[model samples]
Target: MTSPFLSLPGAVGSPVAQHYGAPVAEQRALDAGDAAVDLSHRGIITVAGPDRLSWLNSMTSQQLLGLAPGVSTETLLLDPNGRIEHAIRVVDDGERAWLLVDEGSAEPLAAFLNRMRFALRVEVADVSADFAAVLAFAGGTALAALRALGPVVEWADPWAEVTRGGTQYANGEHAGAEWSAVQLVFPTERLGAVARAVAPAGLMALDALEIRAWRPSRVADVDERAIPHEFDWLRSAVHLTKGCYRGQETVAKVHNLGHPPRRLVMLHLDGSEGELPVAGALVFREGEASDPEARPVGRITRAALHHEWGGIAFALLKRSVPADVTLAVRAGAEAADPQAPVEGVIAAAQEMIVPTDAGATRTIPKLKRL
Candidate 1:
């Protein structure tokens, strides 16, 4: 599908195409004071009617009963088994709710909701095409500038908000670290205005910024069959005490009991010498064979080049692998840079930890579902 924002010059095969309906560049610029993207291509599903909030809360991870109008929660859609079906963000306005999910998962998610719907006073529809969304990122003064425009609600995620307007809107969630997910929406007629208002940049830069932001998303890269715990999303998406929903048992059990069999880790790969290991490339620890067919310790979930760190990639590594083991990613002999060898290159692997005080060690036994 062509990206909706492709007309801006220099956008190629970007994921933004799925949401925008055109092939425009949707990523942010690195050096700018702030950056933005046309998020219209993303899936937006609306659920409304009398049972909106109650019905949704029963189905997802976040507690939604008390979610005030104008506020939103980022959540997940889990399968009956608790494996992640999709990662979603929900914005509510008392009367209605908007769910932002991965582009590829949009249609399937809508279908899932439709199948789950029966007599409940809830209605669901895919609004992604009708409403175009853009993301803006700024710290310090930029947030204040955005706030000056309208009523914005900041959520528990610290640097996040939800705002709306005719040709402009602002919602900053997960904006801390280096980047924020900002949603700017307007009529297609005013896309240029929105783009100009938010300094449009090519999608390539946006991908890089996304890499820097450390925002975990479900994309073609990670795909389904990935448990949320593998990405450490339990901290951000799971509601430990929520009523039984799809996959709640697994989500709950995996958290309070034993550790997840696998964990998400960031790796600094030696990529300057060859094509960076592609997604799905097997990552091997020291002493693992170098043949292209060798069993991998893990698979690369996401990887990108860091100007400061050479090549950095997020991998879902087997928890059984010990820390400090040197890892290797595949580099085909034909394309591998002789300098950046397929063999002998050392990769650093470290579990992605949510930083907290290092002093306490607490483990709680599993609790039965509510």
Candidate 2:
């Protein structure tokens, strides 16, 4: 379905945003709570029935059974091997539990939840078609206005602190402590009116804010091999003391006995080349002029030029790589051109997001065997 924002002048539809005319101006307005962004592309799933909370608590890596109304938390569905499957943003209104997910995931997630309902009084539905999500930075007024449009639920992100039963790997101050973005869900029919009610920013503005906060998102930062420990997701998503779930054993072992094989890092890129490296670009450690054995140690997951930070990226690198290492990202196309022999690269300075010794529990002293 076409977004209602397309009716606005200079509206451009991309996979992420429905941006109106001036994106920069829109971004400033959004940051100041003078505008909003249409994020209707994100999916929504509603789980209803008396057993909603218990059923969700038993299936994911969070302590959700005691979640209070309007309280926001996130949970992760992991495979039996502890690899992340889905990262869901959750909120409840006492009677219904809402799961906000990445685009294209609602149907499959709801289907999975339905299959798990065995004699349980639960009903799962993909309600994405009925509701649209609107986000605003510092959006108290926007939220108050959205509440008047009919059943609306606001989800305040809990990224600033370590949630109960979760662990923190990043030391010192977290970059996301000031993150104040909120998600509001309203009737899909009100989408056009909502778009017209306020100035609108593009997804690019949202990306800059998220990256600056060191916030990891499912759609942009995750892959098949991603584990919660790698991205420091346990900060707000995974509960270490939660009862047995699909990936409980692996989660326990990694947190208590071992470190994650890889870690997440932020890269400050050299924008001198006038272009940014695309996702999946190879990241290599700085090499000596005569060194012929240098190999890529990581790959870029998300890259964007921030209004304040210039070119910045989040990448997954080998845990063994030092936090202070200087790196370079290959700028050439993934498939080399036979006609064009130039191979471009961008230099990047690494900023640690996940610490080298992330799993402190592993350092606990053990008893000597006889």
Candidate 3:
């Protein structure tokens, strides 16, 4: 399908309008629920048959056996060691269960499901080509507009609180308690009509807001070594009481007797220098970056100029890094326009997203003196 955003002014990216023109303004609009994001590039898959929910419950990290229609939840597909491979947002509508994932994830997930189907009844298909998604926050024009596209499938984010049988590794109330992101699915052919009803913003707008909410994304935050514990993902994606599935051993072991070696943090960059470090910038302790012998303790995964927060980012750091110490993110020379380079270390204050004491729920009893 040709992008409805292809010809949009100030649009530039894989499709168009990564930001329509004014990114900060666009972000403000999005926060106020006035705009929707064009997500034609995202992947959508469907699982159909009488055994759909039960089969999925037996394979993934979330409990889906009796999932009611219209409820929104997410699950993670983990490798044997409990390393995250895919993060999937799911919704069932009686006939079939929909799996919404980041771009490039639909094909592999569907293929894996196909091979696992032995007979009992389940069908998997990547319908990304035929269907497209529109992203919106609750109670806004974009959400209302999408609802007008009736008989549509919608999935609201389950981030405001911990789900059933889930544990929140992040202490205190969730920063995103009021967050209300929703995805509306529509036919690819209706791109033109949908575009006309909802005002469009770029993906940048959506991402900036997510950063402020301290949301951990699979594509941006996960590495080959990433486990659900590192990003505090158990709050929404992992069910502690669910029956055994792949990677259950590691998930259980870590929850009971271990801690995630790495932890996710929200970085409050010193925007006084007028520079925001790009993703992958090196993170150091205070003034350590100047020493050639000193190694970075972490790396920025996502950075954006938030509408309300200014320059901020999400970084994954070694859990041993002291929480009270101010950190540094080195924003190097600008390769795009080097005339006035942004060559300097940006001071960062850490906001703990995942605490160092996040896990180890069980205590081993000491043996009595013999």
Candidate 4:
């Protein structure tokens, strides 16, 4: 489906705007629930038939059996060793379960689910070409126009706080205490109707808010070795005591008797140069370049210039990195001198997201004799 937003002046990139010229204002408006974000690039999949919920509940991280209609939640598809494979946003509309995912996810996720269908009475279909998703805060100004699409399907984000059968790893007041993100899915053909109804906010605006919310996305944060504990994801996506699922053993073990090898941390970047480190940039301790062979303490997964927070980013760092240390993000090596230190890096401040002591809840008794 072609994005209706492509024609708007100053709009750039695929269906969604990276920015509409004035991104700061757009960010403020979206956060205040006064504007909408174009997420047409995302994918939607539907699981139909009576066994949809239970079948999914059997394989993923969430407890989805008997999931009530209109309720929003997320789940994780993990590898056998507990590494995250996919993170899916879930909502059921009485007739079928809708799985909303990032753009590259639908095909593989559908194929995987199909392969696991076995004797289940469920059928999965990738309907991304038939529909699109738009983001708004609950009760936002854009709703009246969007609702005109005739009972558009909506998925309320459960990230404002922990949902049932979940856990919170970050302590104290959450920055996202007021977050009320909602996704409205409508027919792709109605794109023009939406374009006429409300103004568009780019992905950057949406991303800044997500960073402030400390939301962990599959497309942005997960890596080859990502686990639920690393992003403090057990709070909304993992059901600790639910029936068996893939990666359940590792999830239980990490939470019960071990810590995630890495933890997610926020990097408050220095934007005085109007620069934000691009995603995948390496993060290091201040002046750690003294040892050219030293490994980065972490890698920046997402970065954005916020309307209020200036330059900000989210990184997955070693769990042992001190919480208060000054850090740096190596944007890229300078072209003139690849070995030059201090040429292409930006200093950063470490804002702890996942706590250092993130796991090992069930203590084992120690014996004096060896």
* Native-to-model Cα distance after best TM-score fit, residue 49 in candidate 2, in Å: 0.8
TM-score, candidate 2, is: 0.92
lDDT of 3 by residue, 218-283 (tens): 888788999999988899999999879999999999989998999999999898988887777778
Order of candidate numbers by TM-score, starting with the best: 3, 4, 2, 1
Q: Against the true structure, whose lDDT is highest?
A: 3
Question: After superposition on all CA atoms, what RMSD does each candidate show versus the true structure?
Answer: 7.7, 2.7, 2.8, 2.2
> How far off is model 3, as Cα RMSD?
2.8
Give model 4's TM-score versus the native structure: 0.95
Q: Indicate which candidate wins on TM-score.
A: 3
lDDT tens digits by residue: candidate 4, 1-370: 5698777778877757788898898898888788888888999999999999999999999999989899889999999999999989999999999999997999999999999999989999999999899888865677766777764578888888887888888989877678798889988988777877887788989889899789988898889999999998888898898979999999999999999999998888888787877677778889873445557888888889888889999999999898888988876534113254644678899877899998888999998996
Give me the overall lDDT of model 4.
0.86
1-370 per-residue lDDT for model 2 (tens digits): 6677767788877644645667556666666676677888999999999999999999899999889999999999999999999989999998899999988788889889989999999989999999978887674466556556654788888898899999889889998887777788888888888877766788776776677789998988899998999999999999998789989888889889898999999899998887777777777787621133455688888777676778888889999989988988777675122233326778899888998888748566689999
Better TM-score candidate (2, 4): 4
**Which of the two candidates, 1 or 2, achieves a greater lDDT against the reference?**
2
Let me know the TM-score candidate 3 reaches against the reference structure: 0.95
Candidate 1 vs candidate 3, lDDT winner: 3
Error of 2 at 266 (Å): 1.0
Candidate 1: regions farther than 4 A off: 1-4, 14-33, 140-179, 287-289, 332-346, 354-370
C-alpha displacement of 35 in model 3, angstroms? 0.5
1 versus 3: better TM-score goes to: 3
Worst 10 residues of 2 by lDDT: 334-343
